[model samples]
Target chain A: MILATSLAIAAMFAAGAYLMLKRDLIRLIAGMILIGNAANLFIMASGLRRGAAPILPLDEPTADPLVQAMVLTAIVISFATAALALALVYRVYISHYSVDLSRLSAAEEQQAERDEPMTEDLRESVRDDTDGEASPDGRHAREAAIR
Target chain B: MIAVPIAVLWFGGFVLAVLDGTRKPAAWLSVAVLTSAILSTMALGITVYQDGPMSLAVGGWSLGVGITLRVDMLSIVFALLSQGVLLAALIYEVVNGVGARIYPAVVLFMGLGLTGLVFTGDAFNFYVFFEISMISAYVLVSYGESPRQFRAAFVFITVNLLGSVFFLIGISAIYHTTGFLDMYRIRDQMPLVQENPAILSATIIFVAFSIKLGLFPFHFWLPAVYTGTRPSVAAILSGALANIGTYGLIRFGADIFPRELRQAAPVLIALGTASIIYGAIQALSRHATNEVLAYSAIGQVGYILIALGIGGPAGYAAAVLYTVLNSTNKALLFLSGSLRGWLAGAAFAIGAFSVAGVPPASGFLGKMALFQVGIAEDRPMLVALIFLGGALSFVYMFQLYRRRTAEIEAHGSSPWGAQVVVVMLALVILGIGVWPDPLLNLVERAALSLPEAQVP
Candidate 1:
């Protein structure tokens, strides 16, 4: 039983690592969920004895109920984190219209470009070059900001 | 008495979570909650410092069998550090303007988490509270609701969750080997356990904290998240959140795994050196304020690691002192980096000076502590490395100041309230630097909490 539990944990970790390396946002969350479960199982597997249930009227030696409680807590925490990750990924998808990390980081670079200047100096130069009406770049900037 | 801070945070955080914290009154309430927690922690610290360690078993369960909440000099110092930092960040954010509805509540939750983790004697409770803090941090990272923030959030969560899993594994391994989840009992049984398993779990736990600290090889996510978030969030991450790493390392390494720590001292020093050089060099090359500070954050933690690596009472004291100073400097820098006034510039300079280990700033005291350790240990090379690291930091901090000066000319000064907060943090650092005896005495006592650090 111990050997089988160890193998299962190993397989889950391996798969989690593989998925975590992928670019897809959902797959990364899936990877986190898997690794989190593996950790939970690892906690459960820490109980060495296979014995009767921990109850009010104990006839014999019981399994370690502490590990059971720990695994439950671990599951709740992991579930909360995974749910947050899903919500965050969905937000990213809606904003960039793609789930790829490359796209999200591309948005980051664009934001960097937008923030690079827009200071007094750059604003002065852009104002000097453009007419009073909205320039193409100005319109594009507004659209991007709204988006 | 030990549970006052934890209970206050619990009820306060629960009440604050439902309120819209972007409003003025709610934000002030959150600040009030954090302040009370800080006061209670300090009050507890006085008791712990004068008397000794205190423990409470929840539900009146037996000490070894039931969950335990323990407070000693070490835990109280950390609890106070985390609470004080959260208070500063919360006030800074409130004064500047809270952007999110949940910002204040999340900060309170994080305070609760840090408080709980440091005070818990049970390993599993530590994990639970650690996750609470990390979960709030995820929300804090995405504060801006921008695509950039989303990317940062994604990276931060994924990377840190992996670290958490590694920590969980280490705890389970400890339990499997020792049949105890209570840290005191585990420590008692650890020697009887075979060497190999203990070392493996120790290394895993170290890796977990190293990742959290953004130590050398695992620092890829740090700059991105630190730069991507707002200044206040960045401060909380570095100032309040990073304590988990420092406190965990000292708690787990020096207290729980002394043998493993001694065995790995050389490796810790090597890694510390790499982190220092790499962080300073990278920070020097970076142009943006946040980015440079991010890299500098990576570099400063190296000193803490080295102090922990040194492994004596003095070494442990140095680790505690430097961590306190480092977190304060980080809080001041990140908070002041966004402000525009001349006062903000002074605040930033004080933070930078502290980082570079200059006099009249708490950071200098931290550096001196390490220097004392180096001299006491009689490793001349270590002293030279400290000197070199300090020089490199001075260059980068000077460069950052020069750049900030240029920008200060272009922008008007910020609000007095915000500037006041920054200046207040600067004063704390300066106060400690000028009169280091109190903090020094406190840290020495905190060090003796660990069996290995018998200072004198």
Candidate 2:
């Protein structure tokens, strides 16, 4: 049982880490849940013992009830965090229409660019600064530079 | 009693949660609740200082069996600091007019979490309170619900949730090894634990707090969150939320894992120095006022870590004093930075001076305490680092002040009466700086509460 629990924890944590590294917001939250579960399992496995239930009149060795209680509390906290994360992600989707982290950031950069109070003439001047590096064969690149 | 403030905040928060926080009556009620909570916390501090630490084990269970709530000078000082910041932020928001209905309740809930975290003697209970505060912070971070705030909230929640996981793992490891959930009992058992596991848990716990403090290696999430949020929320985050990092470091490192702390002092000092340099250089280059203050916060926490690395009664006191002074200064700056007018400008200037460690402000006393720590440790390098950090802060702060005052001159001042609130906060910081004796004695007494860190 101990070996199995340890293996499970390792697998869950590895999976969580992998998911967390992904660029999608949904996967990131899934990763959080997985890691949270792994922590909960760790707390439970930390106090494992072959014993009877911890109740009023236990004649045999009892399991560590404290760890069980703590795990339960941790689970509740993680659940709330996940719920909150989902809500925030939904809000993000509403505003940006995307769940991809990289895309979201790119949009934010564009918005920041738009928010800047630059005159069209100043922008043209700045764009002209990069004219030397503009690709000769690429119309898209030239247009982007001109803009 | 220690429970009084927690109870007041908890019940007040519950009652306030149901009412409309945007209404004047509800806002005034929150102010009243916060006032009572602050008074109770002060009373608790007085009682604990006069008598030693006061403790209560829930349900009358024997030692190590039930959850314990303990309040000593250390807890009360942090409690007062956090609550004071919350109160000021709450009033500032109220005076400006609350935009959201849940703002008052959320601030009260945060107060409950901070007070409970400070007063708890149980390890698990600490995590519970920590979560309470973090969850409230998550909501508060998105209070404006703007695109910038949403992105900030996402980053804040994601990074902080990871930190929370690390903290939980450390707590479980400690419990598995020590076989006790009570912090005092764990401290007693810590010396007997194997060095490898103890070190593992200590490292995990340290990383968790360092992430929260926005120390050099773990500070990626701080600047974005601080700059993206509204100013009062920023004040709350910097002033109240960040206290968890300092308090956790002091309590966990100084008390529970003294041996590990001593072993890691060199690493602490190195990381702290990096944080100082990195934060200062970033602040100097940043043009936005809030962004500069955010990076400056990253720099200020380094002083706390450096003091902790210096470890002794004097060093611990220095850490505590610096944490208190820095929280007030940050709150003042973030608050006043949002307001316009001459009074707000003066408040921001005082806050800027405080950060730069000028006299006639509380920040100078904090710097003096750190200087004493460096001298006592006979580390001239540390003294030199402090001097350089101060010089960098002075330059950035001067730039921020000049830009802000110039903006105020161009535009008219802020709404009526808000500047008065900010100037009053500045006066408090200046008052403490001028009359440093009482605050110094309190911090010294708080430091003595920690178990002595054995010198290597």
Candidate 3:
């Protein structure tokens, strides 16, 4: 039974990793959810194989209360996290009109061009003197040289 | 009595911060509350040092059943480092009128959670407190006006939440095997789980914490999040929040896992070495000021883990000292750029020197001790790695310093208050380095108190 559980978790982890590597932000969030569930199941299987509940009668010795409490807390916290992640995804979708991370990167590149002058000012101040006098040539030269 | 007062101060401050608008009054209130809490914590720490570890059971329950707050030298030292740097940050924010009440509230709750995390005896309670701390951190990371912050917070929250779930599952499994939640109880009961099922559970727990600590491959979220957040918030998180990961690893890794598993210590050392190199390389490659500092933090955390993996009196002391010194220096550097003018720029230079493990600062002393430990263990490779790590740190930090200082020289002067705080932190960093006997002694005492492990 433990072996089966372990295999299942491994499979889920692989799926999660594949999805996470994709360029879509929504898929990445889904991948995170899958990975979290796999870890949760793996944790549960690490204990004794006995299927009995953790609660104990007055006469009977109790199973580990600590483990039960931890699992419950973990479930709640994960739920909250999922909600927050989805909210963020909604914001991303609204702004970029697509959940693809690659598309978002393209948008950022355009934004960077618009913001370049301010950065140039900062670069001028940062280099101060040595390269400061060579600004138009040096800054553009550096950028062009890099490309 | 100490626990009650500190809790009231922290929780109360948190509440006030939430209710108050993003105004100067709220910032002042946060400063006032945290200052008092720091004073009270210092008194408690001195008392613990003079006496020994102090414990208080919530609701007067017996140990191993009810939540217990244990105050020892180790907890006190972390608390002192966290509270002291946070206080400085609060002052900076107040003076700058970056007076967002939510930020202070999140910081206070983070502090509260950390205090409880360090002091709590019950394992389940630790998880509860960790969530409280993390949720607040999530909000804080996204609280700034920048869009990049929103993206960074989303990624960070997702990764950490997954880790937390794994942590919970591991805790449950341990309980099922041993029927215990208290760390001391679990330590005593570890014999029952010494075989396959129990050992596997322990491994899961370690992996969960490793992710949180940003160990090696698990560290992707850290640099982006740290760079994206406001400088003041970044300071508190790097200075205080990240330390929780290492502290958790130590509390669980040393106490719960079987001794044989610890034989894998060299693997952790290797990972630490890798992180050190990777983070430094990234920092050197970055031009964004915060990005550079963020990567530097990653490298410093790697150094801490390496010390802990060594697992001896000297190793433990080195870890603790490194934690304190690194946290302080990092906080100073992170906040320096936000200061008003040129003086702030100078402060950044001094802070960068301290962080790069230069002489006449606590970072140097801590690295020296860590190097000595590696040599004593006859691990010449690890020793060389430590030296390489130090040199890498210098390259990146000096690059940042030189870049920023030039900018300041070109621009106007920074506000006087910002300059003063930066200079003060630098002086303190230097003082600790020159006369480290007192701090070293404190760490020694704390390390000795930990229950001895049966080394394989």
Clashes of each: 0, 0, 6
Local accuracy of candidate 3 as per-residue lDDT tens digits, A15-73: 88788778888788788777777766665665544445665554455444444554566
Question: Which residue ranges in model 3 land beyond 4 Å of their true spot?
Answer: A1-27, A30-67, A93-98, A105-147, B258-261, B453-456
| Per-residue accuracy of model 2 over B1-456 as CA lDDT, tens digit each | 778899999999999999999999999899899999999999888888899889998788888888999898899999999999999999998998999999999999999999999999999899999999999999999998888889989999999999999999999999998998899999999999999999999999999999989999899899889988989999999999999999999999999999999999999999999999999999985656788899999999999999999999999999999999999999999999878888898899999999999989889998899898899879999999999999999988986776667678888888766788888899999999899898999998899888673332
The Cα local distance difference test for each model comes to 0.89, 0.91, 0.74
lDDT per residue, candidate 3, B42-158, as tens digits? 888888888888988888888767777777877788777877887887777766666455777776777777777877777878888888778878877876645666766766787
Pairwise DockQ winner, candidates 2 and 3: 2
Give a tens-digit lDDT track for model 1, residues B44-76. Answer: 889888889999998889966889998888898
Candidate 2 overall lDDT versus native: 0.91
Candidate number that wins on DockQ, 1 or 2: 1
Clashing pairs for predicted structure model 1, backbone only: none
Candidate 1 chain B lDDT trough over 10 residues, lowest sum = B447-456
Best-fitting candidate, measured by lDDT?
2
Per-candidate TM-scores read 0.93, 0.93, 0.86
Candidate 2 reaches a DockQ of 0.40
Shift of residue B227 alpha carbon in model 3, Å: 1.5
> What ranges in model 2 sit over 4 Å off?
A1-4, A55-60, A110-147, B453-456
Report clash pairs, candidate 3. A67-B172, B340-B414, B341-B413, B341-B414, B342-B413, B342-B414
**Share of native interface contacts present in candidate 3:** 0.41
Candidate 1 Cα misplacement greater than 4 A, ranges? A59-61, A109-147
For candidate 2, what is the DockQ-based docking class? acceptable
Model number with the top DockQ: 1
Weakest lDDT window of 10 consecutive positions for candidate 2 chain A? A116-125
